[model samples]
Target: MSRFPTTPDLDRLFRPRSVAIAGASTNVDSPGHDYVQAIKNMGFAGPIYPLNRSADEVAGLKAYAALTDAPGEVDLVISCLPAGAVLDLVDQCGKKGVRFLHLFTGRFSETGDDEAADLERQIAASAAAKGVRILGPNGMGLYHPGGGLSFRPDLPVAAGTVAFLSQSGNNAVEVITRGNARGMKFGKVANYGNGLDVTPGEMLRYLADDTETTVIGAYVEGVPDGRGFYEGLAAAAAKKPVIIHKAGRTQAGARSAASHTAALAGTAELWSTVLKQAGAHEARNQEQLLDLMLGADMLPSSGGRNIAIVGGGGGRSVQSADAAEENGFTVVPLPDDVRRRVREKAPGLADWVGNPVDQSILAGSGLSSNGLLELMLESAAYDLAIANVGEDWFFGRPDASDRLKHACNRLAQICETSAKPVAVVLGATETNNREHRAIVDEVRDDFAARGIPVYPSVERAAFALGRLAGG
Candidate 1:
């Protein structure tokens, strides 16, 4: 009964039978030429028509003078021409029966010029009347992981559960780059620069029903239609999680947003209320936004707020407590029975068995490989357990390294057994200690592979866990 398209429109953009580049050129540095090459580089398996009046060929592909002159039917038309020339191209696309139009030209309403705004409205009107779907007038076009359409020339497309939409082109690039570094792949990414025709609401509606996407993340400076945006988000959140980062929090940020996307920043309280009602998580900043999105995309949806912090250092425990409190998570202390078990298993050193349980007491204990892990698993008070092992030297206890690995594996097994979630926090110096760093990296990698989120900072780990708990 959903009114939105259940399937993604990527077939028209990424896997089109035929594509016509209205402003295609031979100059590699030009935007049109660069885009054409980027599509080819991403392994697009479709016929490409270079529509250049002067050039005989573009990047060795034969050039056609017009979309009509192309050898076959065109599913997509990519326009990288001057802003003034784009309207005519849109008209041409309608005549050619093109279903997808990607406009890379910039001088739309985003420039804040009256003339440019009028032109954008005109183009949208024309496209709507002709039943053509337009992407952007000042946007990053599109990225479809399955069909390998990446607007970014530097990075290859990576398929993931998170679908991202940004209002700023540069912010989209930053998110993609940073997300890639953090092992967060994207199913589809689009920048609705001015959002002349295709708005965030439309994108959300499209992605909400996408089977390939499990989470939706967005960066918004403003919304053209607040009610529509809320409706779309509410509908989407009913099915999957939606995390958003609003940029214009301050007066200066508001002005910057206006200039960047011609967005009219609304009252913060209104935005917050709307987002809360829609069940969308509001992120404070870019890093937190990505953190929340990654957690939502990667973690299970059933965990509660009870968190057990297992780390070597007392400072880590304190930091984790502070972060948990800030994020509205309860840091449950180890029960008396659990503390007694840890002491019994680790009698070689002094034990401080409390909430944010310091596992360092077993640092030099000649305990079995499963000593600390056994203590944690026996304690049923904690819904989620976070283990923070400092360095490799601490793993020197009898089978301690194996114990730590076994503990992590067992924690995941416990989660599977109890239907709860467990995450690990690996805190170690990133530089000036290659050997120790390598050991920490290996442990972190192992934990991540088992569906346990790992973080370098205790705060980050706690934050991710809190978000997972819907805090």
Candidate 2:
């Protein structure tokens, strides 16, 4: 029924029974040694063959002179040899019945030399002829956890539904580590540098029906196969939420991308239009990309723009209102019915309450700040709500720390029942204020555990919500 492989394959590339690190070595700083150690660090429960002609061992693993000399069958080979030498390695792999060869070797077409480009082409042709798929003439290869493989040691150990395919090796690590801190767990992530083999479009096709992947995030420097990308992205986005961060958006950025990965950074305008046509959200920066995924993953879509602000004093309320309106949200006044309900709860204080319900004004009143929020949560006047987890203010009061946690629990419970999007704004990632920072950190974790997305600032919260709503 589906065109893509229902079962993961190029199977050995992911779940290799035996992986031969072709150029694996004992050098502390070398990538050759890093691959072996990285995999071992990830706790891969498989036989590892270190293929080195000269070295007796690599990273303290048993060394074989070649793939053919290994004690047993080899499912995958990671080639860290010179570019010119990859052709010979491919031939050996074909003879050994190796299913996949990861060409970690670079200095091919990326150097912009005609001879190097020709050599890359020859290797690709040879691999294809022998029924072997090449990962890269220049790439970081795969990082699939379920199958027990990883290229870098720092990647998250816990597997998740987020799948990321990045063209920049270092950027892939950055996104993965930073996103992991924000509770963005991952499923399958690959850094397909120079994309000589296993292009972005092909990865998309396979990921489209990948049940393990609920969300797909990608960082592409270029798209040489525009038509293929269009088709694959459209198909995948049809099944799951797709967020793309197209890096090369300017003249300077284009030049950097081209030199960095030998990519042809297409015009920003055309890329933007293409993303819209394919129904993919285009993120301008890494933070924005992270914001959008959180919106897609955590918030429910009501498709309505009305918002009721619930926390922050008059100053914070005004600032939040500006941000919400700037991001296409209608900060409507509290409706009469909701006000009447509030009046019943706190007869004396309801007269002073409005949309924002300044916490200071309601302090001495019989009504709690959360009671006003409960009224706003149900009001039809607002399609969604923003509750500021005022953690900074809660400090120094009697039993205030525990109250903050309880307040967050209440907001999380309200969100669970509300069909509408309810974004919470917590403050300060600035590290100088460790006390405030520590409090915010624990509260953010509390919110995260309760399945609430917290933003550092009101503007960021509003901006992310706006993009998720497509306004």
Candidate 3:
């Protein structure tokens, strides 16, 4: 009943059988060269027709002078041509029966020029009349590794199930690069810059039913159709976890967004209310967005707010407790059974340590922070947990690397085996010591490789867990 195509039909747009890059060029620095090289690098298993008016070959592929000159049918057409030339390109795509036309071309509407805005309107009208869906008039288009499609050649080639829809191309690139570094694998990603013919709402509706996508994250400056965006967001959020970062909250930011993407940005209060009512988690910035996405995809669903905190020294333990409680998680006290086990292991310090088992006090005892974590998770007192690696303490100790690795290995195993969700916290590698940095990086990478949710700080870990647990 919706205007947007369901998953089956949307697949054709994403996984196009054949692609054509209009304005394909020989210069490697330009986007024209990047599209051709990107799809080729992604190993797109389809005919790639590079449409160029003059060049005989672009990116080592035979180039056509026009869309009509291509031998095979073109399913997706990526336009890098000038703004003035887009109308003709759209007509060519319509005549060729092209289902999608991604305009990497800009300078229309967002330029704040009356003539440019008029041109954008005409372009929209023409595309609709010709039955051609335009992804963006000022956007970097799709990036679906599974479909062998990428806008930039430098993007990661590994396919994943975390789908993201961003209004800013640079933001999308940052999310992909940073999220991938933090073990967030992405599936379908689109930068619907101005949301001209194909709005973010329609994309949301499509991703809602997409079997390949398990979690969804979106970065939006504004929407042309507010009602449609709301409906689409509510529908998607009803099915799976959705994280939305709405930028352009301030007046200046709203103006910038308008000039940046021709978007009518909304106020912070209005967007916050809408996101909450729509059943989607609201992220304030890129960091929060990535953290929420990581939590949603990697951690299991937890219904209770009771949390068990472990690791770190006295100061970090206090900090962790404050963070957990501030994020709406109850730093539940260790139950009698856990205390009984602690007494059995180390009777002298059983009462000294509380919910957050201070690693400093348990130094000589046979019990490790990981051991306490295992015992606490086994009890019915807690529903989730946060484990701090306290790498700084290990750095000062004898044989730091070996001890750190051994502890981290045990902690990772505990996280992997635990029925309740445990978010690991390893401080950001900020020390000047080169060896220490490597050890920290190595351990964090290991955790990521094992598909464990690891955060740089306890506060971030608590915030992510709290949000995911509906706190």
Model 3: residues >4 Å from true position, as ranges? 1-8
Question: Candidate 2: where are CA atoms >4 Å away?
Answer: 1-12, 54-60, 395-403, 416-419
Model 1: colliding residue pairs: 333-355
Q: Residue 175, candidate 1: how far off, in angstroms?
A: 1.5
In candidate 3, what are the lDDT values of residues 1-471, reduced to their tens digit? 454445325677789999999999999999999999999999999999999888999999999999989998888999999999999998998899998999999999999999998999999999899989889979999999999999999899999999999999999999999999888889999998988988889888888899999999999999988887887898899999999999999999999999999999988999999999999999998889999999999999877999999989999999999999999998888889999998998887688778887888888888888889999999988899999999999999999999999999999899898878989999999989999999999999999888898899999999899889943
**Candidate 3, pairs of clashing residues:** none
Q: What residue pairs clash in candidate 2, if any at all?
A: none
In lDDT terms, how accurate is model 3? 0.91
Ranking the candidates on lDDT from highest down gives 3, 2, 1
Locate the minimum summed-lDDT window of 10 residues in model 2. Answer: 1-10
lDDT of model number 1: 0.73
- lDDT head-to-head 1 vs 3, winner: 3
- Among the numbered candidates, top TM-score falls to 3
